[model samples]
Target: MSEVRSEEEKAAEARRGPRRGPGPGGHAMGSGEKASDFRGTIKRLVGLLRPERALVTIAIVLGTISVVLGAVGPKVLGWATDWIFAGIIGKQLPAGVSKDQLVASLRAQGDNQKADLLSGIGHLVPGQGINFTEVGRICLLVLALYAVASLLSWLMSYLLTGSINRVIYGLRRDVEHKLGRLPLSYFDRQPRGELLSRVTNDIDNVAQSLQQTLSQLLTAALTVVAMLIMMVTVSPLLSLIAVLTIPVSIAITAVIGKRSQALFKEQWKSTGELNAIVEETFTGHELVKVFGRRAETEAEFARKNDQLVEAGFGAQFISGLIMPMMGLVGNLNYVLVCVVGGLRVTGGSMSLGDVQAFIQYSRQFTQPISQVASMANLLQSGAASAERVFEVLDAGEQVPDPATPGRLGGRTEGRVAFEDVSFSYSPDKPLIEGLDLVVEPGHTVAIVGPTGAGKTTLVNLLMRFYEIDAGRITLDGVDIRDLTRHELRDQVGMVLQDTWLFNGTIRDNIAYGRPGASEEDIRQAATSAYVDRFVHSLPDGYDTVVDGDGGSLSAGEKQLLTIARAFLSEPSLLILDEATSSVDTRTELLIQKAMTDLRTDRTSFVIAHRLSTIRDADTIVVMEDGRIVEQGSHDQLVDAGGAYARLYRAQFAGAAVDIEAQDGMASVS
Candidate 1:
């Protein structure tokens, strides 16, 4: 019963949307994680960008150009400053005196320091005012360079956005396809919510990370290089001082990032586990309430939520330290450059304008390094998500369909035969071994057994839901493995204990059994399955819309709708697995009659626990421990007093004895 309920919940969860809630620390869930194989995952992520290499290359070139232009702006402005200062000094000198005469006069007065300062001001006339015209030209040139750089940067961003979108689009498509190819066993082993996180949350994170960091990384790197070149041109000594901070920043980032990477990985893993719990709780809320486990559920949620918070806080705190540490190093480097540059300028080895320009270059040099260091967390988070997504993409898929798929000609005879079929969920724990059964065309076979007796497993084998470990199952003498799965399933229709209905009108739900089925055909199937009796009483009748959870409908009504769907399909083989188990007595009788009509010429496999329901079946196969212990007509089995007879007596005779005892006690009272 638990397994049955689990299967039902899985079906319902698959149809529903993911349940979302604020994660720990009031942030959205799945903020980020770290990859175990950081370098390998990063390499694979870069491989995804290969298709967009051309656009990426073009964007990089534009970004480089923009950075170069922006980097040179400070140097150009510095030249204008030198010009104005030279003019101011030259204007203070005698109107006709040359710079050489001015210096000679200073030295003759025994002012060697002043004479040296005067000599350092190159191209300064002794009797000239500030060159406002040249200064204006330089300002305009700086403006033009900035404007062009901004334009190119915008273009580069546009190209990168397009390229990134295309790459992510392909990635999502691939993941979707990979999901379709994966075996059912993979899904069985994984939680739906965890798998969903990989598909939705993790993939979205990867896209966002790439979008946020790719262009900025490129720009920051190029800016760093460009600023370094400008700084070197202005003053190599100060440039070298700025360069020293790089090693320190790298060391800090490396240490903190390594620790934070593990935490981020834990944070996302906890997010997935929490999501699975929430999904399970939400889907089974009614069951939880019935069992009065709401408090336990809440406690479990709190524990996992707390785990997520701890992991998130540790990861965030460690990664957050990088920016500030990098900033401190940058500030120290800036102070050193200032002191050195000032000394050089005062000693007449460097001009005031050159010192100012080098200071600006030094700031620019440190800024990109800081930006890159801060982005380490984002990169690690994205790499972790990419690895999770890659795991799904790398999972082994189901056995491929036959290269030359065998087809069942227009219609199938529905003669299913299992020949020495052996299978198991685990290598050592065999569930079905050497199981052999043959269902003749147009015959109804009832399979009855205790729970875990392989009743459903037998049907699953016939449907090829799972492959057999040895031997083969055949349909009309053709091996099932030789035919495509689609072809094999086309002839089968199933109505499980749990009914699955999408959010659609009754008419549409019925038509889903046979897509493109006409309205008259849908109504005919509904009438045959007893759905018409209640549906017509409703305001919308066949047009009444039902939700995915079978809105406002009784359990029996939901069961009937599923039977009507199977009836509409008119499949060659029908599987009724406890189809009437959930219905009341009257409803069950009605369903039984409908099923009897539906099964008229179709081969049917009925798995039931109710001895009364399968009493009239052509053959009753009693199974235990994955093997059929008894197979014969119902009456024959009863007369033989075997497993079937014992089961029948337990259901009917036991009830009779209990009723008689109650009557005797009432009479005595």
Candidate 2:
């Protein structure tokens, strides 16, 4: 009943996907733990950028230069206006006055009305083709600068935008590479779909924010600073009036930006949850339909979707208000500047040009602040993404390989011994308890056990997939765990009950264990596992594409392919965990023969439920619960009347059948 309950609970949890919420217990970052600290993540990502970095760098440089030109152009225009107002309008110069300077200054004015006004204010009659022609030249220069800057800015936009997509590919590749190398236990705590969302959706968000908003923010800030400085130099009072709206704008922006940032974070978190739900439901679609729980699934998904909508709206709503508010506040400041600065100009304290320049400066000042308010949502999204990135980068490393560890070569004879082995998945519950075992070189040892009897767990130990809590497993008298897992696994081969095949050709799958194996070697291994016939029967023979988990083949056929793969690996130690369970009775006979051929020169662990398969095992260990209740040869155990004896009797039923079973033990029927 407890087993049934556990299964039911697992099924239910699997349906819900990774359980998550915006609870207080999340990896919330301090301001100091900025995303910039993700050096490992950055290094890995940069490694993938090797294909496009040169072009990408050129694009970024061009874009940055264009931004500077555009920003500096406005300041130059401000300076031209300031010169006309300050020097020309005041009539008598501050010092070092000359008519050439006076006429040249008018030419540099650029704007006709402004030049004429400054000329009129100057009380000088420096007219004719010479002065007006020079002014035309100055106007032409301003126009040329504007055109060039704007054109490059537009071109840079296209180049950088394309580069952003290229960059995303690099980032995705690096993220995948890192995930592949991470230990399996990492997945035990974090859900697969959630991690996928980080790699895909969250990373995309970060890319978008950096490409779109961050670059613009940098240029906008410089433009604002340039404009403010020009305004202040021209007329401090006028500049003061224009900048009065700044503090108000900043206050409004801060409140909105902060809220938007927080909401966008929630949005990303919710998006991950939404994706997790979709992944969970899709994988369990058959069960969901069979259980008649479609409505419940829809309802659950709806709840998550609504939360996403709320988060998105909250973020966008605050961000959307930025442009309109900035424009409104800026226009209001424009009105104030015109009124006050106009009064000052009429009273001979300033000029019409000064008023015009001050208005331009006001716009320049507010534009960045306004844009940043608009960018608040993007910043928040990026911050959220960076938070996740930092989380992965800052995550603890797995148990590392020891320095100068033993290396296992192909010559390993595969004598394996577990000396007083004990293990636990968690500290509170031990899985294997003092699991002492010895499989002699070139011998087949069968481990028979019920469910939760640590059958597969023992396989995990043999492969060094998990670290043991106590004692040691040795390969050729050297501790397996002391050796790097990669080295240890090099000499061991495992064929799991569930056969997994990649989306590749049959030949590719067969050769994956040994990439350099010749076609003849591949063919021989295929023949040994009895997979050669099946391959020949396929439409494309070895070249047939096995799409999606080898779904084209039967479960038993996939198992045979795995067996063939194991045969190709040709490891010194072999583990057959119910390897033939998926094969038919006829196929099983061939596989049994293949197993005999492979097990001749290597130590093998045979874990099976079929009693007939283990009859010839040099040592048959009958396990109940977690302990080995009894062990011996088939005849010896039957004569001893232990757990193995009772189990044997139950299988063969009578004395005659038992004796017959014992007779065929040397070569399994």
Candidate 3:
């Protein structure tokens, strides 16, 4: 069980650092755009509570009892007041006229007028007009009702807590499940912080509102209806006076609520904007310092921060106006009820007790109106959050898996082919068209070209990360589309330029690709990838913990761990995408040796950043503008004097110049 913390303790913990979770905190809205379908969002939000109908129904029944008991308490008190008045007046009572008999007589006469006046407290007294003991009993009954209602209120809250928690849990689980089904392309355009926010912040907002506002909303509604009924039961004349101000209260609320709704939308949007800015800046703090952009970044942050403040102020200030204005309307209605009741009392048609109860009932009626007025902001905020969460839930998912997927059992020979494949990130601008490439088994194909040469696009198609616009890709003489993604990807291994690592021990990270791999298997793979060299130096060896994205390790070490992970997976087809681009010269040499050994018996496609690294590849395909310009061995490409030769010569010339500059410096020293 989680120990509940005090507000101060929670605040202290918050001050320490960011909260740990599956996703980053702070920014939550995937887009700053306000939800256009307010009603739809609310409908979906309510639908989440369908599973808790039994609990909700019980809460409603109990809530109704509680509101009714509290509403009628004032009227019961009025009965006691009439008893005290009758006693002081020294009025003679009819013989044997018990409280029940008088109430029956009053109702038989069709005069609920004095029935409300004398129902519960009218009992014959020996010398007194009204019985004091009976008066005491009625008062005690009202008090008991109040006490029972309070207990019911507590029970209702307990029930709602469980129901609301389940609903929130379901919502979060849906989001987690949705994320797994979404395609990688969806994440490419989205900010990581914003997606994290949707899961963490937006859902939290919805949960908080449901927890805090749900019971109040139900109670306020019940109070309004029940109190109105009680008020009319007492005296319809004064009830009319109380009811008249309701329209005025509503008009005022509508005006203020409209402004608040609009402002609240902008407020949340501004909050999302601010969160995005903070996330981007903090995540790129090192880059900002390297570029000497601190002042400019601060200025940008201040501008967004200022917008958030202004929006927050507008939203809160407008919403805050609701309570004061509604209070004024309620007070005016109170005065009207009192004035009318006082006139009726003086006219002998109403008793002092009746007047008092009417006044209390009037306050009760308008109090809910005021509460609802105040709840406007919370409702609007919750609706906005629900919209954001629903946006993710409703987002387009990846292409569906085949109904009956083909199997890739045993080892694959890794003969890959692209047959007239065409693709484009955008429909209008085709990047690769009718592109056909075939790699025989155990051949290393090096894709070389200038930037935006459709090299990575080819890899994306091969992996089916994104579906091609036309044609097919095959592995081992089988169309990849016919196979399940799990089956196809199981045969392939990928190492990108940017390495990714989680918060775990080195052994755990390497074993991720092969969860069932034994300790011996992991160690052998690590040794093959040269990760064992550094593992021995650490006190914990493979048990050493890596921080965020393996920040504890150097970029080269992180890459090496990823390579070891791939090696452990034992993929038949390998892809090395600029795997050593960011490493030091010594680290690069080690990585090259490890990669060469790993690729010896597998068909590999190397997307090289440095031309020299792929000099020993079996084939080099030079591409530009989505079309292959030249294809041959390294020596064949150099001798051909085509696009491949030009690119090779340029890289070679740059390397020669760097060597000469280094030699000059060394000679001078």
* CA lDDT of every candidate: 0.83, 0.69, 0.78
Error of 3 at 609 (Å): 2.3
RMSD of each: 5.8, 7.7, 8.7
Single out the weakest 10-residue window by summed lDDT for candidate 2. Answer: 1-10
Over 4 Å off, model 2:
1-120, 123-131, 147-174, 289-295, 622-627, 634-669
**Ranking of models by lDDT:** 1, 3, 2
Q: Rank the candidates by TM-score, best first.
A: 1, 3, 2
Tens digit per residue, CA lDDT, model 3, 1-669: 001112222222234333321122223333646534656777888889899999999999999999989988999998898778777543545655555676678689998766665533333242466667979999999999899999888888889889999999999999999998887666655666667767888899999988888899889989999988998888988888888988998899778877776666676666665676677777677777888888887786687678778977988888899889998888888877878787677555777888888888888889888988888778877887788788889899988888987776678999999999887766766678999899999999999887777787687778777788898998888889898877888888878776777889999999987888999999999999889988998879999998766766878889889899889988899988887776776566667778888898999999885854687899998878788888989899888889987886777657746644654665576
- TM for candidate 3 is 0.87
> What TM-score would each prediction reach against the true structure?
0.90, 0.79, 0.87
Of the candidates numbered 2 and 3, which has the greater TM-score value?
Answer: 3
Worst 10 residues of 1 by lDDT: 1-10
**Candidate 1, which segments miss by more than 4 Å at Cα?**
1-35, 107-113, 652-669
Q: How do the residues 105-124 of candidate 2 rate in per-residue lDDT, one tens digit apiece?
A: 75677544444444434323
